[model samples]
Target chain A: MRTIRVELGERSYPIHIGSGLLKNIGAYCQEAGFALRSPLLVVSDSTVAPLYLPQVEEALRSQGYQVVTHIFPAGEASKSLAVYEDVMTTAIQGGLDRHSAILALGGGVVGDLAGYVAATYMRGIGFMQIPTTILAHDSSVGGKVAVNHPLAKNMIGAFYQPAMVVYDLDTLLTLPPRQVSSGLAEAIKHGLITDEVFAYWCREHAEELLALDLEALGYALELGCSIKAKVVGNDERENGLRAVLNLGHTIGHAIEAVGGYGVFLHGEAIAIGMAGSALLAAKLGRDRAIYEETVSMLTALSLPIRLPEQYSEDDLMEAMKHDKKFKEGKMTFIIPEAIGSVSIVNDIDEQLVREVLAQLKKEDNPW
Target chain B: MRTIRVELGERSYPIHIGSGLLKNIGAYCQEAGFALRSPLLVVSDSTVAPLYLPQVEEALRSQGYQVVTHIFPAGEASKSLAVYEDVMTTAIQGGLDRHSAILALGGGVVGDLAGYVAATYMRGIGFMQIPTTILAHDSSVGGKVAVNHPLAKNMIGAFYQPAMVVYDLDTLLTLPPRQVSSGLAEAIKHGLITDEVFAYWCREHAEELLALDLEALGYALELGCSIKAKVVGNDERENGLRAVLNLGHTIGHAIEAVGGYGVFLHGEAIAIGMAGSALLAAKLGRDRAIYEETVSMLTALSLPIRLPEQYSEDDLMEAMKHDKKFKEGKMTFIIPEAIGSVSIVNDIDEQLVREVLAQLKKEDNPW
Candidate 1:
């Protein structure tokens, strides 16, 4: 097993990536000083429960853990305050203590919502991520877990790190083609923020990744997680450097909120948001060729590179206003200075954003 | 004005204690680079709302802030999850944002619950405290704000700090007698941990403090806040040294929980818990004399230095199991090692705790 540390000082923890890692949880729990008697709650989504929950439960039991499972709905709609309350009720009835640790086993939604539950339950508790989707490659490492508020997507959440993230590549074989494309947007985002070299790799190996070529997929997950771990370790609270990790997320979340979540996968929304941010960056004179190349690569992977027809520019803009990252009523956008380089911009013109929406709409680009 | 810093790096904020500090909020906001927008929400309880809300609202208005006020039924009952929901609803209706700060202008309950509301509303917004009761001098400064759960007091809360705390001394002149004595338990606790000089002051001036002598009260507030600030600055998350601040709070919380919260004022229950801890410390031979002296001083203040008659040892022990500070089912208690030193311990014998309780009950020294 390879260990990548999401360095958050005392809050720092490891992300373990490899096949069959769940069977070896003894060492991970030992390292975390987990109490032997405290029961473990495994939270998974409906899609993941039938596929991986049994094996995870057995592995934990073999390690002398008393395990219980909680299954949430399988999509973005599950990321709500009501579901958070449900999960908390389960935890309370199960008699969880500070010693109790949560194991989140699913895609980005499960990891995000469960991580948030662990963060606020009893002030905070220990949690681990057993990511079951390719998209979790990004969500597992950043410690940015959240639930969607109706007013804004991910408006209610916290920066809670997991005790360990067990990313077994074996689970990706079951991911839908749409989910695979969504995961690639985040991989592409990792490259957009701090690794132009990785961006080049995705550009060259986009087809191989889609085909689930084991070696290529493993490299992508490791690289994405490594970059995120480094960024989150340095700035756990997203004050400055961590915000760079949100390169596509600002507009991406707006798309998800405006389009109504689950319409397009998280990665897909980010893919389009990245395209929008690129257009905004080009208009602001940051870089034009980088924008074109980024969009070309995402489009090549069958990801949506533009907004859907029904979502108006005004609706998207309104959604952006409710984003947690909004500072002083002005929507702050994280745009790339160049491929592998990102910066936060607050002075972008609103009319330019509207014009880009018109251009994307006139071309009938996928939402 | 006396200033104490809660040293949490970027989350760090100051507590300013003096008369008329509320009148200079604009200056403090400007100095701190707070994005000035209004109206501000002044969250208070029934008791403090009538006593100090008008003056505080006028002060903010004089500084060019459009002030709005929210009041809840006073006491520990106001600190439920339901109250938190009410506060959030008010904030949503009032159009609160990162720029609009919450002024928690009451005792510990208001400061804690309102601070929690600020921490979660729109993710998080800035908050200030204008503490009215004598007990608030400690609560207002340390950033240890929270609401109680049905199972445990302070079971549901966060360690969210305020932007600034304006502890106007003049407000204490009208405080009720029980409130004045209740706040002293914390001041006494500060003396037990890293401040022998202050502890001796409490021992010498218990009567003066009860009488609300201005000089004694000023000294108590400043010294208590200073000790709290130092401990918080060193360990903001209560991972280590900060737990020292929880001296007597373990059983103190148990008393409140077992008695259903309102049976004893927070400080009164803590006074009993302090005696329990003192007995345990004496048995362990860890500064036996100091423990006796501490208990005597608390006794002189007319505080309840023994458990309530209605609560059996089993009830207290069972309640202790659910304390927010418990880990792995082992009860951890903070005990005084000397007049000016404290320790967080999970290694104490349970049988010894029972014996200590029996002895205290039979003696009926105070309560």
Candidate 2:
């Protein structure tokens, strides 16, 4: 197992990436000195529970944890306040306590939902992320847990760190192809923001990574988590540098929310968001070469660069305008300056934003 | 004005307690380095909004702030998840940004609900508590913000600190008689959990406090806030020393929740909860005199020592069992060891708990 410590003092936890680690999470918890005062409350969803919950339960049970599992129907819709209430109501029924730890044993949605439940329950509780999908590689490490509002995404949440993240690679081997591609978008984002060599490696091994070759996948996931850990460690509350992590999230969230949610995977939305950011940067006199490179990279990876046809420029603009990153009608976009470098640019002209969003759609009929 | 600094390291903020501080909030924020990043989004409820929102808004406006106001229907019902959603949605609509701070301007409900909104909005932004009620002296200072769940009270929340607290005592003059009694319960709690002299002072001045004698009320509120600030500074997350603050909360929350909510004020419930804890502590061979002192103090303040007639022992126990503080079926009770000190005892005999609840109701019919 390759262990990456997140380096958040006292709140620090490890991201353990390896095959077959799911069966040994009990050992990891013990090492973390969880001294768990109550039985484990394993929170998963219908989609993941059928595939992974049994083994996870067995392993935890073997460790003498009298586990209680609460499963909800899986999807982004499950992140709503109604479901959040259901999860908490069920968690309480499952006999969770202040000292009890909640094991979030699913992908991004489950992690966000369950992590939020752990975050707010009893003011907060111990939480561990047992990520079953690659998207969690990014979400699991940041300590950002939230539930979606009907009008916006992640409108309610907290910056609560987990005690550990058990990234069992064996679970990823079962992730559907679409799920894999959806998750790859964020890993690519990590490389684009901070590491040129890693960015180039991602470009060169695009096919290998897409095909889920174990070696490429492991390195990509580990590297993505390491980058996130460092960023979160330095800026736990995202008052400064952590804002860079939301590089494409502004317009991306707008698009995802505009698409009525669950239509585009989180990373898929992130992928398009990164593209919009790049083009906006280019329009604002950022290196044009970097813009083209980012576009080409996203296109090559089969990530959508064009705005979803269903959304109008006005629709996307309205959504983007509501993004939490937007301040007083001025927008902030993190755009790539070079292969791996990015800058947080604010007050991009509204007409320019409208024009760039339109340009994204114009390229839909490429030669 | 007396300034008490809640010493929570870099996240620390000042609690300004005095009469007429409400109209000077703008000056306080500017001096505190708020810089008015965005227009103020002042969150209030129907009752407090009509009573105090205009003055609060006028003060903020004078500070060169563009204010946006959203008022929901008042009372404890407003702290539901449904209302929590409306607050967040309205906040986004009100043009709140990451830099903008939410001004919570009401009693504990407004502080808890609005503080929670600020805590989770954009993964948290700047927040200030403008408590208009004496009960908020406890809720506002601790950084413990939350909304209630159907199964429990304050079941969904966070331990998010505020930028500053503007506790204007003048607002207390217009409060209803019952409101005064409700708010004093927390001030009494602060004393029962820490300083004997404070407890004695509370008893000695009970009539003046209930009568809203400005001088007496000011001392009670300041002392209550000072005690909370110290406990929270020493332990922000209630991990160790902070847990003592919940001394009567376990059964108290149960009583409040079981009483179908809205029936008893938070402070009223806390008063009964404190009495229960004292009796339970006495049952464990602590000083019996402490129990007499607590009951008499609560009675003098017009706080209920009797359990509400509507809830049966089974109902209260069931509610207590679901408390976040309970561990492995053993409830955590903050038993008063003396008038000034309390101990956190877990797994007290269930029979003793039954007798205590029964004992509380016995005094309902005095000879």
Question: Looking at model 1 chain B, which ten-residue stretch has the lowest summed lDDT?
Answer: B358-367
What TM-score, to 2 decimal places, does chain A of model 1 have?
0.95
TM-score of chain B of 2: 0.97
Pairs with steric clashes in candidate 2: none
Least accurate stretch of 10 residues (summed lDDT) in model 1 chain A? A358-367
Top DockQ hit:
2
- For every model in order, the TM-score on chain A comes to 0.95, 0.97
Report the lDDT tens digits of candidate 2 across residue range B1-367.
8999999888989988898888888897786666475867889988899989888889989889878887999898889888888888888887777778888999989999999999898788888999998888888897999988888888889989999999898988989999999888889889999999998999999989988999999889888988988989999988888988997788788888888777888888888889888888878988888888998999899998888556799998898888777777676788898999988887788888888888878755311
Please give, as one word, the docking class of candidate 1.
Answer: acceptable
lDDT of 1 by residue, B1-367 (tens): 7788778888888888887765676566556555556347889999888977777777667777766678999989889767876777676556566567788988899999899877777556678877877777778776776776666677655667888887888888887788788899888888888889888889799898999888888889989988888888888777788888888888888888888887888888888888888888888887668657877889877787866566788988777767766666666778888888888888677788777767667554422
**Over the stretch A102-144, how does candidate 2's per-residue lDDT look in tens digits?**
8899998999999999999878888999998988999999899
Score candidate 1 by DockQ: 0.36
